[model samples]
Target: MKLIKLDAIDSTNDFLKALSSQEELDNFTVVTAENQTKGKGQMGAKWESESGKNLIMSILVKDFLYDNEQVFNMSVIVSLAVIETLKSLDIPGLSIKWPNDIMSDNKKIGGILIENTIKSDGRIVSVIGLGLNVNQINFGHLQQASSLKVICNVEFDKDSLSFLIIEKIKEKIEFWETNSALFWKEYFNSLFRRGIPTPFKNLYNQNFMGIIKGVSSVGKIQILLEDDSVSEFDIKQIQMLY
Candidate 1:
C-alpha cells in the first residue's frame, strides 16, 4: 500500500513500470498524478484531463496473475472494481463498455489501460492505469464524455475517490482469486447494451447492426449478427457506435 503522489507525469503507468524495474515494489503500490502530459487510453487514443480535476493513477500488482494470457481476467477484475466504487457513490446508469470503459448514462466517465510485463523469471506484473473524470466539466468537442460532477451536480473529492477505487480494486482482486465464475457473471450482467440491437462500425468505417451478446474468452466482443450468427470481433476490428 505504498502511495506516491506526483504533481504531474508523462504517464503514471510508465512511471510505475520504470519504478518496478529499478526496485522491488510492494504489492498494490500506487502512483497518482495531478496531470498527465501524454495520457493515453485503449488503442493509443489520447486521454485528456483537466489538471487536479480527476483521478489519474497507476497501481502495481505483482505476481498475482498466473500467466500473461490471463490479462483479460485482470481487466475484468479492475473494471468491476471501478464500477463497484462508482455504484457505491450512487452514480446512476453505471455500466461497463466493453474492454473496460466506465460509463454513466451512456457517456464515458472513466477508462482503464492495463500494461503487463513478464519478467525474466516468469513473474507477471501488471500496471493498471485509470483515468476518471471527476470535477472537470468541459470536454470541448467530445460529446460522449461526462464526469461525476456533471452527472450528479455535486463536486467530488478526488483523494477520497481515488482511495475508494483503489481499495475496491484490492477487494475485487481478492474476490476474484476464488470466485472467478461469479465475477464473470457480474461482468456479463453489467455489460453495456447487451441483448439490444446496436449499430457498430468496422475497421474500414462500415456500419452494421449487431447485438452484443457478451465478451469472448479471449477478450473480444461477441456480437449476434443480423443473420442470426454470433461472431467474435477483436477490439481493434470493431467499434460500438452508441
Candidate 2:
C-alpha cells in the first residue's frame, strides 16, 4: 500500500486520478488529505468536511482483475470494508445505505464516490474516494450528519482509523477476487433497511412504500412494493425517505 499524505488538497480523488495519468500507480495506492476543498459525493454533490476532523482519501486500484461490468462489486467491497472497520471500533447501528453511504442510527457518517477508467480492451481501473466523519462534533444545519465523536463520545486517532479502514478494504478486495458470490451475499445482508418496508419517492415525485429486497449485480436497487411488484432503480431514480 503506497500512501500519500497531504495537509490539504482540492480533492483526493482528483489528485489520485491525476497521479494515475502521469505515472503508473501501484494497486491500492492511496492519497489522503486533511482537508478536501472540493470533495465530492454521489451525483456530483459536494462533500463537506472540516479540516483534520475526518477521513478524506482516495484509493487507486490499478490492474484490477474484474471486468467492467463487475464495477459495482468494487463499491460493495469498499462499503463493507468501511462498515467492518467501524464495527471493530464498537460503533453501533452500522449499516450501508444503498449505493455507498455509511449510516449509523439513521444518520450518515460517511460516503463513497467511485470513478472507473476503462481501456480499449475493457480492462478497468477504479479510483474510489471515501469520506468519513471522525471527530467533528457539529454539522451546522445538516441534521442527518453525525461523527464518531458525537456518536460514541470519544475522540479517535484519525491516522489509526485510516489505516484500519484501508487494511479492511484490502482484505475485502482479496476475498472478492477469489469468492465473489460469498462477498455479494454478505454485501446484500449488510444493506441498510434491508427487508424493511420504507417510504420512497421517485424522480416524478410519486411516493410509495417499498421493501428493500436487495441490489442487482450491476448495482441497481430492487424494491418490492405493496402491490407485490418488484422494481429496479439506479441511483437518482428513487430517493429513500428518512
Candidate 3:
C-alpha cells in the first residue's frame, strides 16, 4: 500500500509501468496524479478530467496470481471492487458496463484500463489504472459522462475515496483466491443492462437490438440477438448505443 502522489503526470499507468520495470515494487503500490495531462481510456480515447477535481490513479499488482489467459477475471475483480466502493459511498444506480466502465443511472462515471507484463514462465505483473469522476461538475459536451458531484450533488475527498477503492480491491483479490466462482456470479449480476433489450451497432455500422447475455471468460461480450441467436464480439467489434 505504498502511495505516490504527483501534482501532475502524463499518465499514472505509464509512470507505474516504468517504475515497476526499473525495480521490484510492492503489491498495491499506488500512483496518483492531481492532473493527468494525457489520461487514457479504452480504445485510446482521451479521458477528460478537470485538474485536481477527480481521482486519476494506477495501482501496481506485483506477483499477480493469474496468468495472461485469466485477464478477464482480473477485470471482473477490479470492476467489482470499484462498484463495491461506490456502493459504500451511497452512490445510487451503480452498475458496471461491459468490460470495465463504471456507470450510474446509465451514465459513465469511471473506467478501468489494465496493462499486464508477463514473464517468460507465464506469471504476470498487472498495472491497473482507474479514473473516477469525483468532484468535477462539468464535462463540456460530454453528455454521457457524469461525476459523483454531479450525480449525488455532493463533493467527495478524492484522496480518501482513492484509498478506500484500493482497500476494496485488495479485499476482492483476497476473496477471489478462495471464492472465484462467487466473484464471477456477482460480476455478471452487476452488469449494466444485463438481460435487457438494448441497441447496439456493429463495426459495419449495422444497428440492432440485443440482450447482453454476459461476457465470456476470455472477456468477449456475448449478446442474444433479436433472432434468438448468440454472438460474441471483442472490444470495439460491437458498440453499445444509448
Candidate 4:
C-alpha cells in the first residue's frame, strides 16, 4: 500500500481521480489530506470539517465487483472494517449504522463514500473515501457528531490510526472474496435498529412506521410495515429517521 500525505487538498477522491486519469493511480493506494476544501458526501452533500483535525483519506482498488448489485455490499465491508478497527483500539460502543456510518453510542463518528470507475475492458475501479473524526473534540454546529478525542478522552495520532484502518480493510477485502454471503448475514445482524420499529419516509415523502427486516442480496433495505406486509426499497427509495 502506498500512502500520499498532503498538507491540504480539495478532496482526496478528486485527487485520486486526477491521478487515475493521468495513469499515476495504483491499486491499494491511499491519499490522505490535512483538510479537504470541497469534500462530498452521499447525494452530493458537503462534508465539513476543520483542517488537520480529522481523518480524510481515499483508497483506490481495481475490479472491486463484477456485478452491479454487489456494489452496495462494499458499504458493508467498509463499515465492518472500520468498526472492527475501532474496537481493536479499545474504542467502546462502536458500531456501524445502516448504509455505512460509524456510530459511537448512537452518534456519528465517521462516514464512508464509495464510488467506481468502469474501464474499457469492463473492469471496475473503486475509490473508497473515509472521514473519521480523530483529534477534533467539538463540531460546533453539527449536532450528533463526536470524535475519538472526545469519546475516548484523549488525543489520537491520525497517521497511525489511518494505517490501522487500511490494514483492517485489507483483511476485510480478503474475507469478502471468499465468504460474501456470510459477511452479508453478519452485516444484517449488526444493522442499526434491525427488526425494531422505527419511523421512516418513502420517496413520495410519505412517513410511516416499520421494522427493518434485513437487506436483500442486492443491498435493498427490506422493511416490514405496521400491517405486517414486507416491502423492499432501493437506495434513495426510503430514509430512516434515526
Highest-lDDT candidate: 1
The local distance difference test score of model 4 is 0.84
Tens digits of per-residue lDDT for model 2, 18-117: 8888888888898989999999999999999999899888998866545767789889889988998999999999989999999997999999999998
Which model scores highest in TM-score?
1
Question: Which residue pairs clash in candidate 1?
Answer: none
Candidate 1's displacement at residue 114, Å, is: 0.5
lDDT on C-alpha atoms for all candidate structures: 0.92, 0.90, 0.91, 0.84
Which stretches in model 4 have alpha-carbon errors above 4 Å?
A: none
Query: Which pairs in model 4 have colliding backbones?
Result: none
Worst 10 residues of 2 by lDDT: 61-70
Worst 10 residues of 1 by lDDT: 62-71
TM-score of 2: 0.96
- TM-score list, all predictions: 0.97, 0.96, 0.97, 0.94
RMSD of each: 1.0, 1.2, 1.1, 1.5
List, residue by residue over 109-137, the lDDT tens digit for candidate 3.
Answer: 99999988886677788999999999999
**Per-residue lDDT of candidate 4, residues 98-169 (tens digit):** 677788877788988898887777777889999999988779888888999888898899888888888877
The predicted structure with the larger TM-score, 1 or 4, is 1
Residue 187 of model 4: what lDDT?
Answer: 81
- Candidate 2: deviation at residue 199, Å? 1.2
